[model samples]
Target chain A: MKDHEAVIVGVADAPLINGKVAQPGSALQIVARCAKAALDEAGLTLGDVDGLFTAGMWGIPGVGQLPTVTLSEFLGIRPVVHDGTNIGGSAFEAHLGHAALAIEQGLCDVALIVYGSAQRSEMSRNLAGRPATLTMQFETPWGLPTPVGGYALAAMRHMHEYGTTREHLAEIAVAARAWAGLNPAATKRDPITVDDVLAAPTISKPLGLLDCCLVTDGGGAIVVTRASHAKAQGLKPIHVRGHGQAATHWTIAAMPDLARLTAAEMASERAFAMAGVTHDAIDLVEVYDSFTITTLLTLEALGFAERGGGGEFVSNGRIAPGGAFPLNTNGGGLSYAHPGMYGIFLLIEAVRQMRGEVEPERQIANVRTALVHGTGGTLSSGATCILSLD
Target chain B: MTKPHPVVDPGTAPYWAALKEKRLILKSCRACGQAHFYPREICPHCYSDDLDWIEAKGTGEIYSYTVAVRPAGQAFEADAPYTIAIVTLDEGPRMMTRIVAADADAVEIGKKVTVRFVEEDDLVLPFFALGGA
Candidate 1:
């Protein structure tokens, strides 16, 4: 292993509510538990952590402003490097790339990336219009739905131009539910069908209730260090092969194209190029599923399917469990849990799948390479990371 | 609950003030010869401060839209199932507004639309109706 190569030696999620360790607590408390577990898995302690990366919507005015400082103070470890980048849900995936560069540059030795949210527990998530301030003034005053409406616009455009149907979108939800059925931690695992998706109440036109991700209380963490250091610690090192991140626009109106995810295309191209691997070489895939359209557009953006070909590609159970392609094995945010920011959980599940730590039913056999991509905002930002068990 | 209204600031004060007189205006960048919505002091296209206001045709085609079957919030419960749309103006810039139609089916992509001003409290919000000019 290269001495300067960054490797992830530890990954963990906060106490699971439905799966295990159902400890009810604040967002901070949940992250503390998750961080402890990840560090313990790495055979390290807070004293050894010199770098900290964290992001969230939990403590906006006070804790969120200085998220890393709050976490460092609570964890009782002061490090030379710290980053608190909140680019919506993709912030954690972006953190993974930032942490890798920091580790490679010798900025810090032990890096910890963590996120926690209690939106569900606190009932903080509501179908409310964003305040008509700043860039949102043009949107909120029109009573445009916060997020679903933006995605619906994309879906409508995709359908109008590419002959995609609501049924095609339902296939993604059906596939996610099938995967969730095999996941013990999945929030909704009743095994829904395409009809169920179509029958669900429409939150916004073209996007039903089932089309949206679950709003659950959850937290996750990851520990990264040099590959050489990981070997010295007697832990298996999952190499950070490549990572890339990009943002197109904050508001949906400003998005360059309603039918395409330009940020994801840009982000994955850089990541795939840096990793020196093709899409066919990837053994497993995990992507942010904030909405069903999110997964579909990301699949196209990631090159799994041709542009305007995602609807046909995702049809016929291609990405379902026991299907041709393995995707969102942990049920994704759609069926698993989305506590506001879902990127951290994507990394956690990717690391687990690579380490073969997931339930046998959902585990992909012999995963040598995994690609995890996170989409944040209203299809406004994207971050991609490639992990290899080399 | 009252619906959300735009908070006018110095940079956007002129645009909002013009709306009171039912005049639709946009910030036209002299440097880049481009027009943009939600007025700004500097040109977004050229990053130049040499910007001026120009009256817009306020006619465009629906680039995309969503009918909010569910209200955005409590304030919009009465207005559920309203169509929110991005209309590409004839002047070549897109803006977010509501598309008011006699029937919901009248809203669709490529449908020609013209701007309509509605007085809400102290603000006049620009919405669109299904028609050209």
Candidate 2:
């Protein structure tokens, strides 16, 4: 299959507040702000945005229905091409491919992909408070924690089958915090150690508080256009080299293998093949880190390390500062703000790194290529994209 | 005192109904000769509507599990530090349920288990205990 060539022209992130307590704002307001900032970064206005793509309302109260249509109308632009592909956190990464293909096929010119959430400020009581549904009929009745418990199951299985220990998982958190320390925009920048991660209170077995990503209130947006169009607009173009997405199951019960993430394997392979680059050539990796275990599994699934060797791969200060492989330079979801869906932020950070927009302390010097990956829905779905400066 | 119960939908009503009789059943796809849990009308493997409810021996092995040191929600508060597991049925299907043992930590991967009916209020739910326990 011939790869569609589109370029990321602009990327912007909304101000991420700790918002530990429920804040007083809506998803629409935050998303609109992010969209405008991204457009301004690209030197484009609402009139130039012919394509608009977004995910669901993310359970924000009074956001109305249909987030894509609602956000478009709110922005005062009627996009000829629109998409609302909600595949959990990987939605925005998947949209990159969707928008790139649309742009290549002349379906739209400047595609704006946006996401925002106030999950931390809204609190769990206001959001995700629903009556018993299908999941309740099967899994939740057994007290399966929606995500933490679901991910813990996978972590337990990995430990059982691969001898992955808690310390190895803690290494990921420690490394993420180290990276976050250098990022001014990161919500949690305090230095932490593997011991701190292990000592934190356990939300689920093998998953402590430190291992989890912070529930933050934030938004992010990206603009994609044809490579030629980006050059014409005089914007720094980060070429969308390749992209792929896949899902194994919806519920944790149906996950084919708890120890392995097949979707990530499939998606990364397709992406690597499309980008025509091996793991050695990529300068940085930005992976979704919902939990420390999530980052480990993604690394293994993406072939950064051997299948069960993800634990060993992240150990010995490998992913930390000055490590050979720079993982999640912008602190990632673990240390950075994770407002519900974090896929868009992955692209934003990748673009920053490629464009040399980050601080010298945090940026990877002369970064030419970046691989951004997102996992959603209990490690059931995965999306991979390779972006390059050349 | 009451416990959490499964919400019976049109697709899963029969599975819950069979539990009342202390019998375990799952939808077996006649077309693909496969079985699945959390019953649906169509076959997940082959997408065939040609299916039938078959009695299962209720014997399986613990595929994976986690000991919830903390309750997942309010209803499970009483069961704090309980064991939840995905049991791979002998009939070739997986189901999520609790592992009832004297020590939740004793539950290990690949441990053999069999279904045991626990009654909470008017609802009967299938839980798993160590095989031969």
Candidate 3:
């Protein structure tokens, strides 16, 4: 069998509804819009897309099962290959590798991956009456604060074990906002200081409101095809140089180590090995920042910084604009839009940076390669992808 | 407002039932000698169905924790600023629980804790408090 490579030919995002408490649209509407825009960007129509990959419908209540099938029918396309890989926020990143392999094996040529969320509009009601899953049964009874509490627990442990301070976490929020200032589409653009982050009301201890991602309504899509097919279509190809995915545990309680993200270590190691590149060779990084602790842990786990040194590594304006490492140039989930699942946007931004299609002020000069990392399911799942224009 | 209660399913019914009697029990795999929390039908480590329920002394150390300054949902609104923690059991497994009968700020990692049962709407949920207290 020939070792075929898959390339990302097109990427697009639905119009971001920023700062609004609610977006007046259904999840399907947002997803369809983004899917159409992505297909148009690829200079292809729905008919050309032979595969459809999306997260499962179980994430949102009343969204029923077989979301990919529903989406395919709604878009009026009969796909030969379809998948609903539900790994939470990292599901879209997981799709990248799956679609690439499917294209490589000739199972499908064009794959469209997409995600959309109306979380902001659904937050109050969803939180009021969350369904009883295993996590809810075990942890909720004790008043565990759902998502924020779990990540905060990890943060507390990190701080206890390494003496990480709130100032260190605030630096992440401040840097992210600085990057957001350069992105006109970002939801929050106001410059903030470390003191401002610390002063923000606390949601969970050791993680204030500023440490969390913005709740907005948005969706993103990506189109992948064989490198030869992209060349035939005259599309600029962003080569998928390497990809890896792994999970450490299903729930926060089961995590082997609270202070470490072992899955991210394994995932990034496999990805870097496959791409034949080291951390220094990468031009830029796009890491998932569901919370400040997530980014800090990912950096340490991916070997970008020494364990327990992530706090120091991010200090001194190192990750902000005009810094050595241009991290989360799209403002990340912190200042950027986070519509529940944020992995797809990480890939979209990486492709944009690799193609040099972003704002001139934020674009990395002579950008040839980018690494995108995503965490899902309370940091239970991780996916890493390396992309290069070469 | 009504507080959140456990939705005891068949696999975990035994564990919750035992808790109702003020007993803390965890599943131990006979094949691998590993104990796990949030009762499951099969062992997570060895995937063996041969399991036994062992009474735990309920003494443990605080592995990690956070104080919720804001309520996660309406059910927890009255309990804002509560301390939620993962306690590493003496039996070699960890469980998601809360620390009560103490100030939230005073809850520290590595502090010894013991399981305490709290009655909530006819359900007895296990929580951890300072061991010596």
Docking outcome class, model 2: medium
Rank candidates by TM-score, best first.
1, 3, 2
Per-residue C-alpha lDDT of model 3 across residues A1-390, encoded as one tens digit per residue: 122578998898876646432336677877878888898988888889899999843334544378888888878999999888887788888899889889988999899998877666656323332455665677667676667888999999999999899999899999999999999889999999999999999988888999999887778899998887677778778888888999988668888898999889988999999899998889888999999999999999999989999999999989999988779998999998888789999999999988888999899887788889999988898999998886
Instruction: Report residue A199 deviation for candidate 1 (angstroms).
Output: 0.8
Please write out the lDDT profile of model 2 over residues A1-390, one tens digit for every residue.
122458888888877656331234677777787888888888888789999999854644545457777888888999999898888899888999899889999899889999877667777422111245775577766776667888999999999999999999999999999999999888899999888988999877878889888888778889888777677678778988889999998778899889998999999999999999999889889999999999999999999989999999999889998997789988889998888778999999999988998999988998899999999988989999999987
Off-target runs (Cα >4 Å) in candidate 3 are A1-4, A17-24, A56-63, A121-130
lDDT of each: 0.89, 0.85, 0.85
Instruction: Report the poorest 10 consecutive residues by lDDT, candidate 2 chain A.
Output: A124-133
TM-score per candidate, chains pooled: 0.98, 0.95, 0.96
Q: Give per-residue CA lDDT, model 1, range A169-261, as digits (tens).
A: 999999998999998788889888889999999989899999999888898989999998888888878988889999998878899898899
- Cα error, residue A366 of model 3, in Å, equals 1.8
* TM-score of only chain B in every candidate structure: 0.94, 0.91, 0.93
Model 2 segments beyond 4 Å from truth? Answer: A1-5, A19-24, A57-65, A125-131, B1-5
> Against the true structure, what is model 2's DockQ?
0.59
- What TM value does the first chain of each candidate achieve? 0.98, 0.94, 0.95
> Candidate 3 clash total?
0
lDDT of 3 at B112: 92
